[model samples]
Target: MPELPEAETIARALAGILPGRVIRSVTVLREDVVAGSAPQFGAALRGKRFSEVGRRGKNVVLVLEDATRVVVNLGMTGRLVPGPGPGVPPASTHPAVLFHLDGGACVAYDDVRRFGRLRQLSRAEWTRWSRQLGPEPLSRSFTGRRMRGILSGSRAPVRSLLLDQRRIAGTGNIYAVEALWSARIHPRAPSNQIGDAGAVRLHRALRRVLRAAVGAGGTTLRNYRAPNGNEGLFQRRLHAYGREGRPCHRCRTPIERVVFGGRSAFFCPRCQPC
Candidate 1:
C-alpha cells in the first residue's frame, strides 16, 4: 500500500495535471473498488470538474467543483495513469476505474489485486474521515513535544507505535525502519521508555525521512508509481528497510531481519541497540 510519501507524490502529480479538467463520464469496471454503488459513484462524479488535489494520510483526495471529494486509497498494486482522451490507456490491463475528461484525456485507476478504492464523500463524510487520522508527520503539529505526548503511554514497541495510524499517521514499516535507524533506536524498544533526547531525535528523523522519501518520488519496491507513471527512486537510498544480512550503513554489524507484529523489521543490532 502507498503510505504518506507515495500518496503525497501521486497527489502532487495529480495537482499538476488534473486542475480544470472536467469529468465527462466515469467507467467502473469493478464495483468492488467503488466505495458504494457504481451507479451512484458515477452519478456523483459525472460532469464535475476537478479543482485541486491533496492527500490525507495514505489517501489521495481529488477536490471537485462542488466540494465533493474523490478519495482514493491505492491499496497495494494500484496505479493511476493519465493519457490522451478517447480510450483507456494501454497499460490498464486491470483497470478498475476510468475518468474521462471533457478534453479527451482520461485518468485510469488500475489495480491488479482489486484492493484499491474510489469513493466520493460529501463534505460531512470527508470531515469525519479526516478527523479519524493523527497529525500529518510532515506538518508543524507533529512537533517533538507532540510526539512525546503520543508516546507517553502504555507499553508498545516503538516501531509498532509508529505504524499506528492513530498515533503517527502515514508511517509504515519502511519509513519506521528507516527513521528508527536514523534515530539510532531499536525496533522493539518500548515507546513509553523513550526519553526527551530519544523523542526529539525520533521526531526529527521522521520528518527528514518522510521528506527525503517524497523527494525521491517514494520507494517503489512494488507497484507504486507517480501519477505520471514513473517509478520511485527512494529504494536506491534505503538503509534498513530491506538490507537484511547486509553491512549496517552506520555500523559494521550485519543488519538483522526479524518479524515483528507480523511485519519484517530490519535493523542493526549494534547501531540500534535493544
Candidate 2:
C-alpha cells in the first residue's frame, strides 16, 4: 500500500523525469485503469506536456501544460515505473496502463489487485476535492494544538483517530502504530483521554516518525517502491509494526498484537500502558 510517504517519494522521484516531458502515446491496458472511457482518457493526455507531478495525501498528481490534472490513487498494489520507464516487468507484475514518452522511454502502472483509481480533474474540480482533505500532518497548520482540538471529545479510540484521513491525512496502519508506541500511548486509549501533554507528544511523534520514514525511502512490506523501482529501507528501522511477540526494542517487553479495523496493531505493552 502506497501511503503518504510512499506517494510523496514517488512524486518527487517522478518529478525528475516526468516534468517537461511530452507524451507521445497513452495506452490504457485495462478499461478500469482509466476512470472514464479508456480511449477518452488517453486522448485527453496524449501529446500534452507534463508541467508538474506531485502528491496530495496518498494521491499522485500530474499537472499537464494544458491545465488538465490527473490524480492516481494506488489502492493496494498499484506501482509506477519512474524515470526511463520499466521496459516491461514480468508478467506477474500485472501491468495496468502505459505512458509512452516522446523518446523511446515509457512509464507504466502495474496493479496486481486492480484496486487503484485514476481521475481527470479540472483546476476547480481538483481544488474542491483537495479542500475535503484534512490538514497535512507535515504542514505548519497541523500543530499539536490543532491535533488536540481535532481529537477533543471524540469517542473513537486513539488508534482509530490516527487512521482517520479527515483528521490527519497520509497516516495509515503502519505509522499509526509506530507513532503511538513512540508516544507511549496505548492504541485503544480513548481519544478524549489524550490530555494536552499526551496530545503534544502524539503530534510530535507522528511528525517525527513520518519524516524519518519518508527520508529513508518508506517502509516496503509488500508491493511498495519508488518510481525508480527502489525498495524502501525504513522497514529495517521500524520500532513497532510486524513485530508481534518479539521483544520491544527499548523495553525488552514482548510486543503484543491486536486486530482492529481489519489491520494488526503492534505495540510494547509495558511502554504503552493503558
Candidate 3:
C-alpha cells in the first residue's frame, strides 16, 4: 500500500506542477476503479483547473478552482504518474484514469490490482470525510502525549494500534514495523502495556522514520513511484520489515519475522524485546 511518505511525495510533486493546469479531458479506462458514477466523475473534472494539491493520511487531495475535491486512495499497487498526455502513452500499460491537462501534460492513476479509488466530493463532503480520519501523524496535533493517550486503553498489539487509521492516520504495515523496530518495541506488545516511556519513544521513532522516508521519496517495495515515475530510495535504508534472518544492525542477532493477521512483521529479537 502507498503510505504517508508516498502520498506526501506525490502531493508535493503535484503541488509544484499541477496548479493552474486546466483539465483538458478525463479518461476512465477502468470504470470499476472509480468510486462514483463514471460519467459524472468525468464531467466534474473536465475543464476544471487545479487550485491546490495536498495529502491527508494516504490519500491525495486535489482541490479544483470551483472548490471541488478529488480524493485518491492508492490502495495496493496504485501509481500516479505525470508525463505527456494520453496519446503519448502513459507510464502504466493501462491506466485506470487519465487527467489530460493543458500543455501536453497529464496525470495517470494506475493500479495493477484495481483496488485504488478516485472519488469526487464537494467542500462540505470533503470536510466530513477528513474528520473521520485521525490526526495526521506528521502534524503538531499528534504529539507524544497524544500518542500516549491513543495507547492508554487499547489492548491491541502496539503494531496493530499504529496501523489503525482511526488512531494514527497514514501509518501502514511497513512503517509500523519500522517504527516499532526503531523504538525497540516488539510488534506484539500490547498497546495498553506500552507505558508513557514506550509511547514517547514510539512517537519520536514514528516521526523520525516517516520524515526520513518522505525525504527518500518513500519505501518502494513494489508498485509505488513518485509522480515523476521515480522509485523511492528509502527501501535501502530499511532496518527491518524484509531482512528476515539477516544480522541486526544493533545487537548482531539475526532479524526474525513473524506473521499475525496475515501480515509479516520483522524485528530484532534482542533489540525489540517482547
Candidate with best lDDT: 3
Residue 220 of model 3 has an lDDT of: 84
Tell me the alpha-carbon RMSD of every candidate.
1.3, 2.0, 1.4
For residues 61-107, write the lDDT of model 1, one tens digit per residue.
Answer: 99998999999988887778888445546367688898989768889
Sort all candidates by lDDT, best to worst: 3, 1, 2
Per-residue accuracy of model 3 over 87-169 as CA lDDT, tens digit each: 56567765899898987778888889999999999999999998988889899888999999999979999988888888889
Q: What is the lDDT for 257 in model 1? A: 91
TM-score of each: 0.96, 0.94, 0.96
lDDT of 2 by residue, 103-178 (tens): 6667888888899988888888898988887789999988889999987869788999888877778888989999
- Candidate 1 clash total? 2
Clashing pairs in 1: 85-104, 85-105
lDDT (0 to 1) per candidate: 0.89, 0.85, 0.91
RMSD of 1: 1.3
- Candidate 3 accuracy as TM-score: 0.96
